[model samples]
Target chain A: MGTALNPSYFMVLSAALFAIGLYGALSRKNAIAVLISIEIMLTAVNINLVAINKFLTPEAFIGQIFAIFVITVAAAEVGLGLAIIIAIYRNRHTVDLDDFNWMKW
Target chain B: MHFDFSLLTTELSMFILGLATFVLGLVVPSRSRRGIGAFALFGLLAVLGLTVLNWDQQGVLLNGMYLVDRYAMFFKILCLSTAILVIFGSLRYVNEHLGNHFEYYSTIVFATLGMMVIASAGDFISLYLGIELMTISFIILVAFRSQDGKSLEAGIKYLLQAGLSSAVILYGFSLIYAATGTIVILEVAHATLQGQASPLLIAGMVMLVAGLGFKVSAVPFHMWSPDVYEGAPTPVTAFLAVGSKAVSFAALLRLFVAGLAGVHQQWDILVAVLAALSMIIGNLVAIPQTNIKRLLAYSSIAQAGYLLVGLVTASPAGIKAVMFYSFLYVFATVGAFTVVAVVYNKIKSDEIADYAGLVQRAPLAAAVMLICLLSMAGIPPLAGFVGKFYLFSTVVSGYLWLVYLGLIMSMISVYYYLRVVLVMFRDDPKDPAPIEMGSAANITLIITMVATIFLGIYPNPLSEVANSAAISFFLK
Candidate 1:
């Protein structure tokens, strides 16, 4: 049953998700939404890691461990992001990306 | 399964020192936290001492997850001194504007520890963790002045971009993992050569360059730097410019020149293009910067471009040039920023125009800034000149075009750097009062200024150390 779907299918799905996530990350106006997009992209990376681990390298669990590390690091990053976002919001009253431009080139 | 305890001594000491500084920061009263900077300075000095004591203790530890070698030691020394100088520069500003946040001292220590780890990272896991540790610490440090909107904005921008780049780098790592079926860097190098280039591997390598390129602030990835430098406290900006950028180069040199030697042909051109773009864009953008910090940011970006030229050589001399330049860079960049912080503390301005008559107000600072900027402009009789000469000479035979572009752009850079110098010496002061700076800041400026000139006049000792470090990595 597990062999019913090909690994390339998962790869394609991961690529599509990554493209969407990257587009949203760059284009989104809201800071939180941009963060969510970054998370989505990270999730896509996890799928690639896990799929490759399960299908290609069954002998080694390196990919699984890497996936775990990524998840943990991403959690910490989100926590830092939220703290900074709150700080910005308290001072400026908005998390809009455009509104955050006080210091220009 | 042999673990080398001696090989881990410097890093272990640094880790303990970071924890101690953090606890000390927490226990001390807010007003008394002024002493925390001194504590951090002592801790960093201890770590530097350990690094020197263990300089020749080279081995692989944690099953090759970490390496203790001359390459790492050279960078460790550079990073530690950069942190110490930054702390020295920060003492007065932290006491005055930052309200005795002892945590400021600890975060920098932690950041220095992270950079040291990056310098020693022998595998992908350690590399990723090291980079994340440094970047996260920098984010918090950048936002240390939480009440300041500009600082908060800089922190958020750093967070968003750094997070995105981390994700991208991870994805690249995953691809490399899939292609090679290993995360150990040395193993990956062997596997990549045996299997040669696949589309997945090629894409992975490109993403790796792009991600690390962001860390080094190469053009197209350098947009965050000017704003972040302008907003962050001046001392942290110096740390970001010198320590963070140098660590990025350390990791990059390890990964590319050592871990991916087989694929050098594939990525060398990519690095060359990035170097050219960074040189052209960084210098051109710097010409128009009125904010002194932003100008330094752009100048640092241009410096990164110059450093990247060494990467194009793909030889032992190239690495030596990079290591030597990184050492010289710490003195020039930190020295300049210390003076900037001193002035900002006095005048509450970062505008270049406001720096008019700085020589009359603070002759020593003006002089230090002059030497540092002159060094950065690659003028003769300064460390920057010798560093650039070494870098260009190494690459001239192989990448003459890059050398030409670097020489021309650095010439262009002299214009902006000298503009600041002219403003300092030529213009009249609006406030006719001498700028007062703490003795520690003055000491840091004097030491860095002396080191810059000494290194310029006498390059043999540092050049030899850099060459040894370079030889150790490429030989393996």
Candidate 2:
């Protein structure tokens, strides 16, 4: 192998992913789209964790273990999020975020 | 490597209870499913009793991933009681409005179990698991009334916000893990103290605070609360307000005052600012709420501000005050929500204007609402008053400005809390219909009301308990 890539490279990649995910989650008008955005953010977190485990905390694999836990939680959260979206869709026949205006400040 | 069985008895029992309730819901006949709420209540009460019995069984498990200290036990007992009351108070509402789905009770039980775990979480992994478990269950519970548009709307809103916050927290945790190379809170604190304060570490801390602040509905992160509270089922609203909010505070205490003790100087001003913003924004926004649930939601945010005062002090006395205030808040919020559930069950409206002449319609409920609202407003001779005093006094030596801001906010909060009160007593009856309440709701209201008053008068006993709980983490 020539030379190992710096951990900062992975960090930058994950941070970029996190920013994009945050943007999508904030600006998306569709509930499904929002859920997907959140998933992307979670995936960015997982990447950060795995990279840190590989480079920084290699002795314990602690970051990888956290990544695994995060993935599991993300899976569970998506399942619940989809279920809630379906529930909302059933009531209003739409999943558009703007249509969820039955409640307002 | 030895695991202490007694240290986890309350959590273990609660987990078993949640599983049993879910199974029981499946086996019971659909028509008879309503009994599951009472069954869950019974199991929760037993778990509450277990928490009290294990009050002195302080120990560590799984290499300090879980704790059974007095602090955790006190909050566990508080969570159990709040869960029990939620079940009881929502029993009739669930039966009528939500059609007695057994999943309703089972999910609440699971959520309560999650809260118990959160109360004892000694590591980041446990805290994350506990929080996700609780919020996931809440998302389902908030949409329990699937046919209602508002309920579904609330569920979706809560889901989106909860998901975003969870992602934020995970990112923050990943950063902390990068900086400290550990996920165990105690070890992380040690690492932080031993190492120079890297900019990465402080950024991670800020992210963590922002994420957790959303969980507690602190200002700037609190946009989701009023809508979610208004649209969710009333019983669930109560659970969200009291049980979930209290457990968030418990976790905050662990993370801030204990887990991050070595870096207190960096986070103290951040916490104070969050508290100040929450108090001002929550109270100010609550003034315009027309729906009772929304008003209470904003008020709950203000309460979170007051609770944050305890954390801002960064002292054991502050933690004790937080525990005591959380205790008092459970009763007051639950009492108020119980009455709201009763009223809504009869009148089918949550609007404050719909509550005109509530005194004439339901004298007991009106009185309970009065007491709860007044207590929330921090009026003297009530539990909220004493709780606020403890919190403010604890921090006054260094943070006098916070106390003054809290005092002014408390005064401002009075206008809105009493707005509901004045409508109930001073306005003419809109419907003038006699409200019929089930025995469970009546019992819940009475128990919470009495506890609110009793704790206000004799806070010494609970204060002692809180002091012991606060000492558990601080002394180490």
Q: What is the interface RMSD of each candidate, in Å?
A: 0.8, 0.8
True contacts kept of 1: 0.79
Q: Candidate 1 residues B1-476, lDDT tens each?
A: 66668787887888888888889878877667777778889888888988888788778887678988899999999999999898887688878888777778878888888999999999888999999999999999999899999999999888889888888888888888778887788888788778778888888888899999999999989989998999999999999999999999999888888777778889999999999999999999999999999999999999999999899867899999999999999999999999999999999999999999999999999999999999999998999999999988987787889989998999999999999999999999999899988799989999999999999999999999999998888655
Q: What DockQ does each candidate score versus the true complex, computed on alpha carbons?
A: 0.83, 0.90
Q: How many residue pairs clash in each candidate?
A: 0, 0
Off by more than 4 A, model 2: none
Please give the lDDT score at residue B131 for candidate 1. Answer: 96
How well does model 1 score by local distance difference test? 0.90
Put down candidate 2 lDDT per residue, B1-476, tens digits, no spaces: 67668677877788888889889989888888777877888888888887787788867777778877888888888888888888887787888898968888889888988998899898888999999999999999998888888888888899999999999988888888888888888888788878887877887888899999999999889989999999899999999999999999999989888777778999999999999999999999899999899999999999999999999868888899999999999999999999999999988899999999999999989999999999999898999999999999988888999999999999999999999999999999967878889788888899999998989888999999898888987655
lDDT of 2: 0.89
Q: Provide the TM-score of chain A alone for each candidate, in the order shown.
A: 0.95, 0.96
- Candidate 2, A1-105: lDDT as tens digits: 798798899989999999999999999999999999999999999899999889987787777777888889888888888887887777788999998898888
Summed over model 1, clashes come to 0
